[model samples]
Target: RTHLDPSDTLELRSAADARQQWIHYESLTRDLSLSLTEQLRLILAPTLATKMRGDFRTGKRLNIKRIIPYIASQYKRDKIWMRRSVPSKRSYQIMLAVDDSKSMGESGSGSLAFETLVMVSKSLSMLEVGQICVVGFGENVKVAHDFETPFGSDAGPKIFQNFGFEQSRTDVTKLVRESIELFRTARTKTSSSPADLWQMQLIISDGVCDSSEHEPIRRLLREALEERIMMVFVIVDDVRNKKKGESVMDLKEAKFVKDESTGVSKVKVERYLDTFPFQYYLIVSDVKELPGVLATLLRQWFAEVVESSN
Candidate 1:
């Protein structure tokens, strides 16, 4: 199902106007996030498999946690002596990386990126499904919110600040590598960090990858796949900015222009995303459709992971 932004567009002529728009959008996003999260919780509640140890009939391992409760109850051996530890299932871990290159800013892309990121991540967090890491990339990859860090008002504004259209390159390969490294580094810091959780990387990009960056990115993703890291790509196509009757697929063709000012070449995003080795992916022509698209993806993914664990 598609979701269209209900609020009318506000012209941003000054910093004050921009701030007002940001506040308005943030409020709307938070409300919608809560509503969506409630639905997600309902859908996923039955699938959650975390169960504490129970004291009942005798078992091989003693359940220390229930000993005090068992003594307090003063129940019979059959009712209170036996304690079994039901091993919990593995949890889902998510990495949300967004493209912050210049092309992504066109066609009011910034708002769409911001809206989609907040809506999906906030909803997932509320659902308490797993640990989540948010990263933004352009010239360099930046971690907007780490796994241990809480995603609140403070993290939201950092995305807005670093989302400038100044960067000319979208080095997604670096972004993924860095994200994986961060996860590894996190694991080293603690024995029980994101190492064992089912890792799913959901990358949000405009598909504006440069020509030289494609093969390396492809190879890196292939390596990631070999290591059992699930990849889901979300392509933000420039459909609204297209000329008359140009379909979304037309955005896959690359157009290159040299920047004489900086002696750098800028390339239009070549979104031959169908060839990419993503386990699951989708293209969104209209930014407004993003929240719904992501919600559906997440629901299906969470359901799949739960099934796999079971």
Candidate 2:
């Protein structure tokens, strides 16, 4: 959905008013996020309906076998029992890289993307899904918020609102490369990291990438995939075109190959997406649909994490 132009809609007399509005929005977002997360958890990983019961074999329940030994000595807790049905450890980090180039703003798609990011980020934060980071990229990369920032805070949104998308070019390769470095550094600093930690990168864009940067970006993505990092490329398009395939002009439409002794032949193929190493989704720029798509993806992410943990 096209967002109202802040220049035309916002009439703030003072910075305080702006701050108040930001706070109000943040609170509302947090509440919405919490609700969404609860529903998702129920659908994706419902708590076992079976009641907790004492197990004579081994569990949090006192071992009856140890009762005889305990009778002969002072009662003390022992490792004789295990935590029953303990939830698997899932250590994953989520980062969202938003395209903040001028063209994104031209159609007001950028604002819609920002809202989707903010809502999803807040919801994930409320669920405590994983360490989260928000990055905005145009000609340069900007870390709008990181795990250290308080979840559901207005800081990230504020930074996004003030960010100018006047850059002449989009450097997607630089953005991905920098994000890799950031993730590496973060993994080191994180305490009690899980054995099979995974990283999820969500790239929300119009799929506009400079031809010169495509190869490098592709290579970086391949490296990330090799390292078990999951990438989600979300292409925000017009609502009229809800079909999913790929962005037009995402790759060369026709390739000409010359035979050694014959004339050149043009080769046509479907989405060159297979050339890249990531899951791709084409969705309309609707605020409601965007968040639902992200939530569903998160559910799948959790399922994957559970599988990997096992």
Candidate 3:
């Protein structure tokens, strides 16, 4: 129902080119919010208006008010709850583990990763998620920022550049083991255990792990699973078909590979997949889709928590 004025310049060479561009642009704009409810009403009147006015006593009539609540309830059921000690307090902690390897830099993928992380982090802050700690790793791990309070507008780009330096390739096995050990050591050093607080760890990586000498990551993952820690893995790659091409193997395949020489387990492969525990895995072809994907994921997650609270 929305019409484009002839005077509206699409900055294209000709009207034909403009028309073609509009088609693509319109698809993306389908998910965007309209300026006013009247605009939406005008567009839907011809088709949706008739459906909305059908016999309410029958099954065909659409009750907008009831329909909204029903859809909202469905979303609420999909969220995951984080345990907290204080009944009145509503917040959760998120730990981010970002891979900053030489390969990421070479492919110019680090920028994309950084941007995606920044967007997620900022969005979480707006949702009033509690303390957030961002850790960047290559050969070593370093804290980019630990925000007790929400990050400001200038914080994201600054934090991105602060930990943007590239190092050696990523060793998932070693990184997981070391990060877990680091957390335990820090907890011990403080002599304070906040057992009531819920902790969630999220890892962003390309899944191309480092060499075979690294220790098994699976063992650490098993421990995390036993501990009931919430873990998420965001795998960024363009891998479509698994059979015809090389793809990052899931935890099961990544571990317990057979060796023809001595019929022994492949230690390197075992270490990488087993050490890092991931409850949820999200695979995306590119970073451009990350923002929308993350928004939807978080909305689902939060909706559940909100419903449970009520």
Candidate 1 at residue 206, lDDT?
67
Q: Which candidate is the best by TM-score?
A: 2
Position 85, candidate 1: lDDT = 45
RMSD of each: 11.0, 7.4, 17.2
- Which pairs clash in the backbone of model 2? none
Q: Model 3, range 80-137, lDDT digits (tens) per residue?
A: 2222222233334567888888766655555445545654565455544356677788
Best of the candidates, lDDT: 1
Report the error of model 2 at residue 62, Å. 11
What does the lDDT read for residue 115 in candidate 2? Answer: 58
Instruction: Compose the digit string of candidate 1's lDDT tens values, residues 1-310.
Output: 4354434222223334545555666676887787777766655454444443546576555666666776777743334334334444445567888888887776456666666677777778777766678888888998767777766655555545445666788887788678667756644554343434566677887665655666776777777755556678887665666675344455466667788999888986555554454557788765456656666776887677558768
Model 2 lDDT per residue over 1-310, tens place:
5586676455433344545655655665665566667665664343454344443345666656667665566654343443456444556588888888896776456655665666667666766656888888888988877866665555654555545567667787888789888888877877745454667788887666654465777789888766666678776664444344433334344445567577767565544544443454545456556556766776776677569767
What is candidate 2's TM-score against the reference? 0.68
Q: Each candidate's lDDT (Cα)?
A: 0.65, 0.65, 0.54
With candidate 1 superimposed using the best TM-score fit, by how many Å does residue 237's alpha carbon deviate from the native? Answer: 2.8
Residue 183, candidate 1: C-alpha displacement in angstroms: 2.1
Number of clashes recorded per candidate: 3, 0, 8
